[model samples]
Target: MSGVTAGVLDEAIKKAAIAWVSVEDGPAYALWCMPAENSIVVVSGPGEQYAPGLAEATRATVRLRGDHGGLILVVDAVVDRLEPGGDEWNELAPQLATKRLNASGTADDLAARWAGSGCAVVRLTPAADSVVGAPDLPADSAAQPPRETPARVETRRPFRLHRVRKR
Candidate 1:
């Protein structure tokens, strides 16, 4: 649907990681990284139902990559998606009153919950960093072996020549 391929996914994951690391506070919750032969998939779902689906997708991608010895990184964020009107909200209110915030805890809880939901469960063999990157051969890899050109054969047919004097 998103025209996502293995290379695209890997690039996306790298971008997300770069962005996440750039933030002063870092990501609020864990991020999923799945690498494939030609791409990688990165999913960011911080809420209840959404997180599970995203995690599952990430795990599946990782599994696929693993078959080819790809690499994946799952960064666990320690926060949970707060339900609009759930018991957790009530607890959060009291903690807010006490000036005790659990941003990391909240994220970790969500990650743990998603993990328990049977999401992000994939056994993949990690690949070297070099394996992940542009699919094109490096420009300096060496001039491409000279390509062989097919020989061309000429076939001539005889034609009668007629000479006409100007009238």
Candidate 2:
């Protein structure tokens, strides 16, 4: 990476509270993440956001948004799964939990439940030469249809202030 590109990537990764990660060239999913040890840490599973194919992917694309929520930088990243209870997990998990906002419990408590809850902690190490910023970003909006979900607004008759009809 050039000095400029490296600086931009580092700043973006550090300031971004959420990143759009596309696993195995699939659709990008917005996930909460933290910058740690020059890499990005993201957790996904039950009780957390879902990042399809992230748990098994060897590589992925990470897109960081600017202050205005527009795409600022795109980079290819090496995906590594942190084994629960291992050295890496022990080191990073608490940090991630601390970064998590509106969490129900203390950092230690949250990190403790992660393994049992089947959460996958993934580290995305940005590739040195894959940084693509402003001028090089694609012209396309990169929009996609929303994924299927069970929740929906229920259809019902509108309620009237009075039951009787006016003559």
Best of the candidates, TM-score: 2
Per-residue error for 35 in candidate 2, Å, reads 1.2
Worst-scoring 10-residue span by lDDT in model 2: 1-10
State the lDDT of candidate 2 residue by residue for 51-135, as single tens digits: 9899999999999998888998888999999998999999999999998888999998999899888889999999978888888
Over 15-68, each residue of candidate 1 has an lDDT whose tens digit, in order, gives 432211111222222334333233332323333212334333212212222233
Q: At residue 100, what lDDT does model 2 achieve? A: 81
RMSD each, Å? 20.2, 2.7
User: Over 4 Å off in model 2, which ranges?
Assistant: 1-4, 154-157, 162-167
Given candidate 2, what's the lDDT at residue 112?
A: 89
lDDT of 2: 0.88
Q: Give the best candidate by lDDT.
A: 2
